[model samples]
Target chain A: MKIIVCVKQTLDTNASIEIKDGAIHAPGSARIMNPYDEFAVEEAVRIKENQPDTDITLITLGGENSRDILKTGLAMGADRAVHIIDSDLDDFDGLAIARKLYEVIKDREFDLVLCGRQAVDQDRAQVGPALSVLLDIPAITVVTKIDFSEDYSRVVATRQIEGGAERIESPLPLLATCQKGLNTPRLPSLKGIMAARKKEVVEITDLPNTAGSVENDAKLRILELSLPPQRKSAIMLEGQPLDMAKELAQALREKEKVL
Target chain B: MTDKSSIFVWIECQGEQIKPVSLEALHCGLQLSESSGQKVCAVLFCGSKVPDLSPLSDFAPHSLKVFSHGRWQDHNSQAVSSTFFKMIQEQSPRLILLPASNHGKELGALLSGLAQAPLASDCIEVECLGENDFKVKRPIYSGKAYASLALEGAGLHIITLRPNVFRGESGSATVLPEADINTTEPESLSLIVREVIKEAGKIDVTEARVVVSGGLGMQGPENFGLLEDLASVLGGTVGASRPVVDNGWRDYSNQVGQTGRSVSPDLYIACGISGAVQHIAGMSGSKCIVAINKDPNAAIFSVAQYGIVGDALEIVPLLTAEFKKILNG
Candidate 1:
């Protein structure tokens, strides 16, 4: 079995992201492989653990810094890493990005393709399913658990539903999106990190035409970004605290329709 | 007035009733259509008898088209996508819009492939940049940030707009030409939905604006009643963290996180919840977040505008009573 996981590099959640001069800036914080993508990498590695002959490869497209993300994947036990570096690639939308990634794996034969449900940065949640479309494969998003048949020809997976869970079964040559519950992502061991330095981190610069006819780049650029408005604590109130709270509550219910 | 350049709104239906989001989509479609001087039409797909199209008459458009396939009684993405693709190509609508729900996401992505167009999924806003050009805004960085996008190249733009960001209006019902567009269904080979596991809930979180979510600090299932009370007071919904769901304090459907349902409520109140990254991914887009946790350093507080370090059980009742008074007054 062969698996390809799409990983993206993004700013850590703790970083104070701000837009200055129309560019989002992440100061000082080190970039990490998207946490969601970690689930995808873990699932792919787990598949190989079960099937000794399995090979897991990490594929990503970004600038040179993306190599760090690819290295992280390599440290997590992926067989190899492929990075399509293009400084001009930042403007591509979800469908275009999906097409480029799909083109990379279209000719090669792979049993499964795994991706995080959505990158924490983009939040589009389109690439995985869109890639499934371009590759002409079946895909289930937000998969919690996936099990293969004894023959490894079919899979039984659990999908997250609105309030509960739904079980789905799909055959091989499928795209499964990973959410958080599938498996615990393992930390890279000392030996693994050392070995990642020697792993092949091939960079492809030639970009394939995304087959899109409209050349609409980002048109709605942010003029300025600012923090949200501050909300003040109006009154803590006195006497029993409960009575004042109730009075304030009554005033809110009566005056404000939000309740 | 019928225009050569038209905007098509994909109306989703369950049996004979139209989904609420579809109406919301129509409202957006109307704005785009009117602004671009293009005729706006509602395209509805149904398995059997065409649903009540008249209920949607209040959302008047240039026209209405109903597509039917008897076999579509079952939920099949390929069948629906293909049907929509063929109809869209035949009509040559300049732009196509759908709701950014599960079905819409699947259908929009698939049709984008079939039609060879760029798709901006889960967008909250769309603006006409120029003649037939659009700039779409979508949330990025989970709900922590947003990005504005513009699709260039294809004349027929395909997109799935997020709900709640746009409001639905009761446009004066206008009648226009109706067209029936249906195409052949694709054969399914490998995947089949054996059975549907349905979750029980009065309101879906995706459709609710007010949500009361609990985290691990709630202790156990018995304490969830406090959340329910607040939710009832607000006429809102209830959600839980993965831990709470795992503890059986709330149903899995009520779970909000990366692995759970993503929600964009107007007011999200987190009680005794330590905001984990995964949990924040689901509700970070909420308009306002109120965090009630004993630990002031909880990650949830970073994103919460209002934070109260107190017992959830103590705060919830007071909050609920306060809300009830506000609402009643």
Candidate 2:
């Protein structure tokens, strides 16, 4: 079985993200793999463990820093990596990103694809489904459980809904967006970490055989980045736990009228 | 059929009731219509049978449309997308607004790609800039920062409103003309839903009006009963932070924050949860937040509307008792 897993890098920011010159700047934050993508890679690796011959290819689009996630995927036991890097690609809308991924993977042979249900940075939840649309393949988003056929020709997956879960049955060459409950992502083993350094990673500067300009075709454009409107200052309750609880309950009913 | 330039709002329903976020999307549609002068069209999705339509009268959309099929007993969507594609081609709506929900966001994004339409998913605010143009706000970087997106020009546009952000309102009683739109055949779709698995009587944290959440401070899974008791007293649901969920102290469904569900409830009480940026990303939109953690410097307090510095193991029960006395008395 062949698999493709899409990963993204995100900023681990706290409450203080500053917007400087129309862009969000988190001064002291560290870059981390999009948490959802961790689940996707974990699932893909689990598949490879069950079927030793399975090949897991990790794909990510970003600047030079994006390679960190790719390296992380390698350490997590993926077989190879594809780095589609462009300085400006980081800010493109979901449709444009989907098109780029389509260009890179269109020729690849794969029976399955996986991605985090949504990227933590943009929180768009678009790429996986949009990529499926571009690839003309079926996509099951927010999938938490998956089972593959012995012949590798079909799959059954469970996905979350508003109030319930749906079990879907689909043929091979399908795309699934991984959700949190899918699996607990494993930390890279010491041996796996060392082996990752030697893994093969193909790098691409620009999308070859360009279909159309991603910028011109972008449906949505970012106007600016700014802090969300702040909530009013909190009222710190006083006294013992019992007194505080009574005051809070009263505040809920009388002050907020929410109860 | 409505005019070609209407703003179509996909009203998502489960069984007989409309999802709350769908109503919020309709509310967003009405607000957009007031500024754009476009009619608001409510499109209904039905299960094996068409649910009653009278409930929609309260929010009275300008026009109504329905698509029904047996396969839609759950969220079977291949047929649904085809039907949506057909409708878009024939009617050519100016804009489509769907709830940024599990099903709705995916469907909206798929349509965006198929149609190559510009889309902004999970937008908290939509302001009409001018004719056929708009500015939308969506939280990015896990709710730490918001991106203002612009959708301009004549091409079709789609926006998915975040759950619980927009307030629902009663629209004019316009006595809408209802129509049955065509549905794509389930046989042609590539997938099938074998069954729907749902925990009986479980309230989705995203859909709940109140949420009582726990984190690492709860110590262990066994202690979550304290949050459950508080949640029950408040008539809310239980939620958990990533640490607790990762530790297997709680199910992923109960997890809130980046990687889990983003919830914006009327009231959110965080217990033993030292707020992480990812957790705040999922819940900063909550109307009222109360944080109870031993450390006053826990990040959760900065976003909370009320803060109580104490051990959650003890504070939670006291709060539950107080709520019980207030509510039960």
Candidate closest to the true structure, highest lDDT: 2
DockQ of each candidate, alpha-carbon based: 0.32, 0.61
Q: Which DockQ-derived CAPRI band holds candidate 1?
A: acceptable
Model 1, A108-163: lDDT tens digits are 77999999877766666778877887788988777888988999999988876443
List clash counts for every candidate, in order: 16, 1
Residue B73 lDDT (model 2) = 60
List candidate 1 stretches off by more than 4 Å.
Answer: A164-166, A194-198, A210-241, A244-252, B1-4, B14-17, B49-55, B151-154, B172-190, B241-262, B273-309, B318-329
- Second chain alone, TM-score for each candidate: 0.86, 0.94
**Largest TM-score belongs to which candidate?**
2
The lDDT of model 2 is 0.84
Model 1 over residues B51-130: C-alpha lDDT tens digits?
Answer: 66776666777787766666555455655676667666566777889988766776777777666666777877887767
Worst 10 residues of 2 chain A by lDDT: A209-218
What lDDT does each candidate get? 0.74, 0.84
Report, for candidate 2, the interface RMSD: 2.8
